[model samples]
Target: MPVAQDVIRHAAERPSKLAACGPGGELTYAELAGKISGAARHLLRRGIGPGTIVALALADPVELLAAVLAADLAGATPLIGDHTWDRRRWSQVTAPVGPVAFVGRPLPYAAGPPVRREPRPEDPAWACFSSGSTGRPRAIVRRRASWTASFPHLSDLAGIGPDDVVLVPGPLVSSLYAFAAVHALATGATAVVPGRWPARRSLAAHLAGATVVHLVPHRLPDVVGRSGSSLRAAVVGGAALAPGTREEAGRAGLHVLAYYGATELSFVAVDVDGDGLRPFPGVEIEVRPEAGSSFGEVWVRSPWLADGYLGDAAGPLRRDRDGWVTVGDVAQPYRPGEVLRVRGRGDGAIQTGGATVVPEDVEEVLRKVPGVGDVVVVGSPHPSLGAVVTAIVEGAPPRALLEATARTGLDAAQRPRRWYGVLSLPRTATGKPARALVAARLADGDPGIRRLT
Candidate 1:
């Protein structure tokens, strides 16, 4: 794996190239390289090196990237804990790994000299925690080399370059942010990240000059509606981009690419020029069913897959003897020898009244409901039918009108059984709704939850 020092090597050769533009403002490659080196020196002075995990609790985008690069330079594994994570949670997350240095707070001087260590291709680079299957956060492991493998493609395939200004409207702690931050650095592109993704302001960043935008589909509709920006391309992932939204973006002259990948396989499948998604160069894809539009599991073998999950008994998601992996995303063949159509996440399937339904498929229909401003369909636990379908609406709607509209688009068993309304949906860092959080609100019977319109 090329260490942070190697990334710096590129910066030294092109010092004046624009490296980043975050809340900390714009920085040249030289300045960014210097920050990384300075933080590396700090870690080295603290006697931390290879295999060590450092907890980063700050929200500053540039500083977060710098600290991550610094850990790589020091040959230490950096665990990117959320800035909003409580100190107790922070302590518990870093408990398995070695000592952790909190990035934002001032640190005490080391009592010992620096330790020098080298990084390897398989060595852990960062540990990103996700609210796991049980709703508690668990670390998702990645290596430094995995990121470097996809570096060249950032410029070649993703249309990111020195002149491109890439704005990522999400937390740096998230895997997508980590990938975008590093990709911007590798390509010498300017990265613009907000402390939080304020929809209107995020669109303003693009209108101001951002050429590339990393966004979720939910936010894309609002972003597109808010600004008439000169955006050439948008990289949308983390959720489904409805056909309506894609058509809207097309009308806006913005190329909307529905990226299919996850934390496990960074930038695996990308669709360009509004074509269906396809595997990148050097990446191999295998479809399980090899049949019609009925989706099957997608397995990937790429040079960029992560090494393994740290301390977890279960192995990395679907790595075989041939180095293939699958994160359980379900897809169907879109076009012959062209691209695959991502149906929805495997775990998000809902069985309502003994009939199977995917919420994303249902949500696509809900998005088209005339009075529906925003909506999320989920399976509410039921005593008789296994799980009953429920719809959360955000816009003005009479319950009967929405149900009538939705019924026309969905099958009898697939339509939502319960309808509810809320001022807003609970969202993750990227403004995508958190099902668990939304469920909690529904369970609490908050007055804000009303009959769906």
Candidate 2:
């Protein structure tokens, strides 16, 4: 069964349980099911199902959930659209995905039957835009069975049940928060989604007593700083999880679990209770290093992987003759199923002084240093070295602290030659350091980033 049908089961088993809460207020499973059924009927009556892709361009989390699950029930694949994107960003992602039934407006009501028939479990249930901070976004379509298989595995791993209240912070347009919201409903847990992403200082109120809160790692330090948070766990992903952030989370009595996942490969590896990154439940991963490369490409094989990019030839997702897929992420080849450390995207490597430096390798060392919250390392134009390794980092760190850490952990080529500081790095909609934007700022010498002595 698709995840949408799971909600119907919850409606029968625990009808009065809170299904979801957002700006539109809370809805019980029974109430939510009624709305989904009505909306799904409306979609099918209008001849939108299976073949038709429904673009859910909703900023309101509550409405998006209703519309998305309803679209699934109606057998139409829902494309989660990011409303926060400007016209240019939107066009960049959508131009390739031709002819979708864009649902920018509220869904119409059904005049007749509530449901015609169930959607195929094998057909696509959702399509989401890739949220890589440095690269062009592409639409990754997913089959209904992929999410269906994930619900049970993920819920069991997290111990989510009807008693848990899961909080999804980021906009639903981003796959991170979208999965969190839908996963909560699929597991019969109450999902609370704020109208907007909460400010760093205001996150505690949203987290208090919530069993689980899903967010990106960039915001983890600020969120963990707030006291009196009785959260069962804070599940973070979409960026490198800083060592300092995890340490701070421990001091605040917040359990933080980080996962390394892409829009194409749903949940590849997860760090449970700070044990370290291991293959996610039911996901098979291996590191395949190219010749003369220290870092190896991490390939994953799983049922949860996305179908494929919609209509883009230049996308990063690649597959071998075998069923394994890789997005060019380089990682340390630990023993088969043992702990893994993702170096960074291969295309993101900096060629400085005739040696390649992976930004994540440098960032990992810097992240362990005191006072560095988050960081992005890019190649700065250098006449002698082609491009020198330059770092634009968030958090106010003293010059001595960074220099000392770099000197000890990094070699000559890997160490950042130029150091710049910002109060905070610009983040994508998914809350990752916007590397492309920062690279532009570096090129233009934007005053937003002041040179660190």
Clashing pairs in 1: 397-453
Report the lDDT tens digits of candidate 1 across residue range 295-387: 556788877776556566242266668777876555664433667766545335454443446676678878877777788776676544556
Candidate 1: misplaced stretches above 4 Å?
A: 1-3, 10-17, 94-101, 104-118, 131-134, 199-202, 225-228, 289-295, 313-316, 333-338, 347-453
Model 2, total clashes: 0
Q: Please, what are the lDDT tens digits per residue for candidate 2 over residues 1-453?
A: 656677888999999998888876889998888888888888887888878888777767787899998898888888887665555666666778777777765676675665656556567778887643223556789897777678777777667777899988767766888888988998889999985567655566777657788876656665665567667678887556655778888887777878887878889988877778898888899888644445566799998898888875456588888899987676766666578877655335564543446677788889887788999988775544556788877888887889889999888778888999998886645576756456655656678899999
Candidate 1, overall lDDT? Answer: 0.67
Leading candidate by lDDT: 2
Question: Which residue pairs in candidate 2 collide?
Answer: none
Per-model root-mean-square deviation over C-alphas: 11.3, 11.2
lDDT of each: 0.67, 0.76
Q: Name model 2 segments beyond 4 Å from true.
A: 84-92, 132-135, 200-202, 346-453
- For model 1 the TM-score comes to 0.70
Over all chains combined, what TM-score does candidate 2 have?
0.75
